[model samples]
Target: MSREEAVQRVAALIKGIKFCMLVTQTDQGRLHSRPVTTQEQDFDGDLWFIGGKDTEWVHDISQRPEINLAYAQPDGQNYVSITGRARLVEDRAKLEEVWSDFYKAYFPEGIDDPNVQLIHVDTHGAELWESSGKLASAFALAKGLVTGERGDMGSNETVSLE
Candidate 1:
């Protein structure tokens, strides 16, 4: 697909989904994964998230910086895997902009808490897959009839494109 097409597809996926699993390398050089609150996608390959400073992910990412972020539909069909280096951003203004009702369920005290943090992952690459196979593909066709667009999925190098 063309650059714009790829981006549009990624944006659509991000819009339809919110939660993602962020994996980071620990101090002892071990891989660890955790579910984090995804904030927003500017559709420019940068994803925003909020987490705690004292969290294990914060410690691991602080030392290694490298990370892998994966998002998938609950049915286990559509999925996106992004790899990149995460940079910690502590800007207060940006924090309030991405809040949702779900966040309060996790952090009731909100962003002012010392543990509150934001992470920006510069996605260098990604592998996206959607199992809209034979059975589901037909559903996509029907949806396209109404929406005027088809759901196409696969993987690509977001980092190399730069």
Candidate 2:
């Protein structure tokens, strides 16, 4: 697919997913991953997420900006893996731009909280896999059982945002 189409497809696949795995590298070089809500917005190669200044991942991003974001739609068997560089965004206007009530549960003090911070992930590239459905999987299984051949799974592609 073309670059723009690829990004659009990734956005569509992740639209219904409320959360995704945000992976960062610690000072010890170990990968740390945690669930973070997916901000409601169009995926135009840049992703925004909320966090706290004192949070470990924020610190981790400060030291190492390279990161990965993984999103999955289990029922549809659609998944996306995105590699990018992350940085702390302290812009008040931008923070307010993406603020939501769900965040209050995490930051009791609300957006004004001294610790509140925004993470900006600049996309590098992404890989996506999407299956047709259970029927297709069953068909694949039956095909394998009878013909010993794997049936068509679905579509998979690697996209570059750069």
Best by TM-score: 2
Best by lDDT: 2
TM-score of each: 0.75, 0.95
lDDT tens per residue, model 1, 40-157: 5466777778777888888787888889988887454667777888989987777778766666666777666666778777766666675656556667777788899865432334
Q: Tens digit of lDDT per residue, candidate 2, span 44-138?
A: 88999999889999999999999999998888889999999998887899889899989998899999988898999999999999887878977
The count of residue-pair clashes in candidate 2 stands at: 0
lDDT of each: 0.72, 0.90
Error of 1 at 15 (Å): 2.4
Query: Which residue pairs come into collision in candidate 2?
Result: none
Off by over 4 Å in 2: none
TM-score of model number 1: 0.75
